[model samples]
Target: MGCIASKPPIDFSADVNFEHFKLLRSVGRGAFGKVCIVLKRDTKKLYAMKYMNKEKCLQKRAIRNVFNERKILESLQHQFIVNLWFAFQDEEDLFFVVDLMLGGDLRYHAQRSGAFSEDRIRLYTAELMMALVYIHDRNIIHRDIKPDNILMDENGHVHLADFNVAASIRKGSLLYARAGTKPYMAPEILNKSGYNQSADWWSLGVCMYELLRGKHPFRGGTTEEMLEMIQSAPIKYPTTWSEPCISFLSGLLERDVTKRMTITSENVQEVLKHPFLASLDYDKLINKELVPSFVPDKDKVNCDAMYELEEMMLEDNPLHKKKQRLQKTTMSKQEQAKRETIGAELQRIAEKFTVYDRSKVKSTPDVALDTNIDDDEITSASPRPQRASGLAVFSNEHDSSHMSEDENALRGDSDSRRVRSQSTDPDPLELPTRLVTPVVDDGSSTSSPIQA
Candidate 1:
């Protein structure tokens, strides 16, 4: 088997401006945002750009979740996970540039093919399990693992997408966050008992069951009824299924967390040793040497519903009218005061320091400073004002001695100077205090995890 070469490392320091990319067409939509197929003007590279309205995200109290998702995506590098190339934010929106998977998600392909064969299911399960192992090893839990979140690349390789609800926990710690789709949620999560990484195994079981049976093992019409069904219902397996297949499902779908296979990093090997997965060479599978049993049609678009929704959403997008109503839609009195305070502090800092662009400097004779002349008229060429050893531009007013060399290198002097200008003031980008209560429990129901 040939070893699959790893992708080149992405330049995390690269500052991407949204203006450099042109939106070709809408591809998908979610709770707080929409995704579009965008083309980079300079590189002509295609990427799926996810844009979220800042105001809407704030209203939903999902700001923390958004930040977490970005942090996790930036840190991860796996073949079976969607890679984040760039992340940036503007006044109105947050943007993420990720690899474009034209093959769409597993749910779309599943719907098109009806029930998948056991061999195909085994291949997908093995690939996804590898992804889970990689993340879980790092103490990250992908809370949602439904078919919709599992995307396929052009070569029919499955990649886990969407980390909005994922959480990272300390070793041996349990998370109490009640998030994820009801159908794929583990018994511990549904019961509001704290859950750990083992919960993802439960979701994988549900996903595998759906793929083989063409429906969820446990089903109900309402959320409450679904919760009850998950807790009480016995998972029925078709008599046609082999004993090894039934054993694998039983182990993963175990309600008791302690009894479940692959509860912690130490037990992951046990999952790989299951009889149903005996045919797979774990090393070759992880290295991408094993040929996939099925491959998606590269010429045909896999998801028509996503494109249709995007078309409808782009027509009435509120962001398009932001500039037109900028004057009319003014901030509240409190927000206005905060902005003024921030602006005043910035102005004061700007008056004290001047930043010189190195590239713009010209060879000219230095002029002696005359105390009688106005200081503004003559731009004193004083020995290029010796660039501060640490890229610090502000003279005597701000102290950047605490900043590390790596931090200084990542931030351009111009941007760093601007940030230092407002250092005395409170964060201007802080989310406003909302009247709505934050969701700490299961009372605040989120949208179904199923992709449209």
Candidate 2:
């Protein structure tokens, strides 16, 4: 197998006809291509347009994958998932025009703040769970459900984005090839065994674990080691973790996919009745009533900081370039070696930081600056501030001194910064705070898990 380059060539001519859309700034860049912020000339609506190189895509044989993603997205309609406005292809590049998610992503937010409140986590998790149910109902499996792919709109509505790895499900059939972030993949996927929509539930469990813990449940040296951990019952809940939350996660992370949470399965009902989601109003969430925890005044990631991290990693680690798999292209031997090196290093960092007990921490940050705890109060900040629903370290005083060259070089940290920003800012659209209705626990329950 060829090692795909995780990083794309930085230099590319911008001669493609964008029609009436004017390019603003580059929002995201991956192995596949780059996503640029643009405004439609006529409608004046902002959009994030993804540009995929045709020649490169053909080399990777992802033409079908790209077309399938577009078809799947065009046919479905859901508030939780990101909206795909349109897809077009020139001779050299494929363009995907999607709704511009101003909040960036949950992964970026989490890294900047370290962690989020249980309440905020619950809000996002419930929203995503509902999305999974909807997508599965349509016979689509969103293989990738990590924070980066989960986006937030100006209205604070959560939208699941990035369906490049998504696939359709046939009636009573199982999927063969397994793909997704290794840490987020279920045991059945890692073992080369077949799976279906249940695989998404397992990834959801990993996402929930990451939301509260700020790290993956399983970290290992090799892919095999990570697989081993998932295959066993070594998932340890933090000492401060609530009983109900643990019960819910345990069911989702079950090794047996048949026993995992499914929309139509008893486990879904069991999860809904758990105390973790006890605050969610299922009707409101399903109806798009729940608002996102954070929104940004401006639609932009901290690219300067992120680019600095990438450069520092390239210089310090030498293996930084290959730390993450590039979905756009095939991997090369050198890149694969680098990926292994970085993945191992990242596992060490995850283990070290996983010690923070979320239950003991305050839901919001105790800042030295005078900021109101009320969700409606907006302080007189130069850039304009919003309600702080979760913890974010993006204070006015956050200078180069607060971050070390080595610390800023890490990849996951940059990713988590995106998530933290979602809950820290006021929406650009001046949206109202849509309250999340807590789940009504009927008092009917299931068996508990073995104490960790």
Candidate 3:
């Protein structure tokens, strides 16, 4: 009997790996990897695929750092933060599929919206405080808390991103690694003194100041100057800011870790104690019940399209061209031997790399829900909007080496370094920390991420 043929049943038990995702377009780049918009082939779910070339990672001695990031992310799950979904590796690249942030980063919005209103900033701070509480409770310290790390959902609620520089401190021992972006680094980290969770609040203060005022509270001409200023200089606040804000910033931006050491231990509300977030509902914030005042327009892809240009335009390998090149090339014996050596190294590394699938865990519900955008809504390419500026990349990391290499080595991302120095009059994205104007457009171009 000529019966209708049936399709084969799906094999959901298979491991989730690099082959499961279809690269959509390059969205951004890190020191050792490129972040691309990708879709899961089976479920058609969208995500940001952070892939690092095995050879480059090994050459740059960043293979361990990439693996550390994956491990740290796998153990963490929270709302108000970019959560990792799947981590896997291939012969060519190590891949991390994470939540896709389409609303752009805070720096992008600050360039457009200027200083967030006091009410808005209040909410933003409160939300992040909750996130920080969760992280600190777990003994993890997020060293880099700059505007670039604060991403927005389509709903405009801020979520903390980037854990490449995060370090876990033992119960009693303090973190001595000199990590974090210089502009937002806590003084304790800068001076090489041991620091704990307090350092994160200090960076939060820096962000608060930038959001409340358009400029950073500290500014300098060079790295040494910046370090000196951040260390020795007293932070000044504009009179326009409310007394509550002044108090908040003073507590957060305190140079003496002793001052903020206890108050900011587990949460931001301890010192203020219902004063700052007196009206807030902690439960609602955690569940994302309260809506943000500002919602990013969904029509626009809110990031500079440079990453896409680099991936598609510059012919950076790893698209269909990579397959084509490999297919066409006829390797000589020497080249084949070299390739075999690399393959062996990759195999050794791959054994240690664990594979994760989020769907396997049904006990944990969605902490932060996925985007509402349907599969068809993404189209062929996640087209970026024009004037989607938030282009900044850090140059170097301060390698104190006080702690283990795995703790501090992940801070430097060397994709490329382009420093744009402004004459100090605009949104204080990655600017000096000396009493900034509200983060708004003053008819001048914005500042780029600091390169220290």
The candidate that achieves the highest TM-score relative to the unseen native structure: 3
lDDT, candidate 3, equals 0.63
lDDT per residue for candidate 1 within 264-306, as digits (tens), equals 4465556667889888887888888788889876544455432
Better of 2 and 3 by TM-score: 3
The models' CA-based lDDT, in order, is 0.61, 0.56, 0.63
Of the pair 1 and 3, which is ahead by lDDT? 3
lDDT ranking, high to low: 3, 1, 2
| lDDT top scorer | 3
Models 1 onward score TM values of 0.67, 0.63, 0.76
For model 3, the stretches where C-alpha displacement exceeds 4 angstroms are 1-12, 261-274, 306-308, 320-329, 332-344, 361-452
Model 1 residue 114 CA deviation in Å: 1.3
lDDT of 2 at 381: 16
lDDT of 2 by residue, 369-388 (tens): 11112212211112221112
Cα distance off (Å), candidate 2, residue 127: 0.6
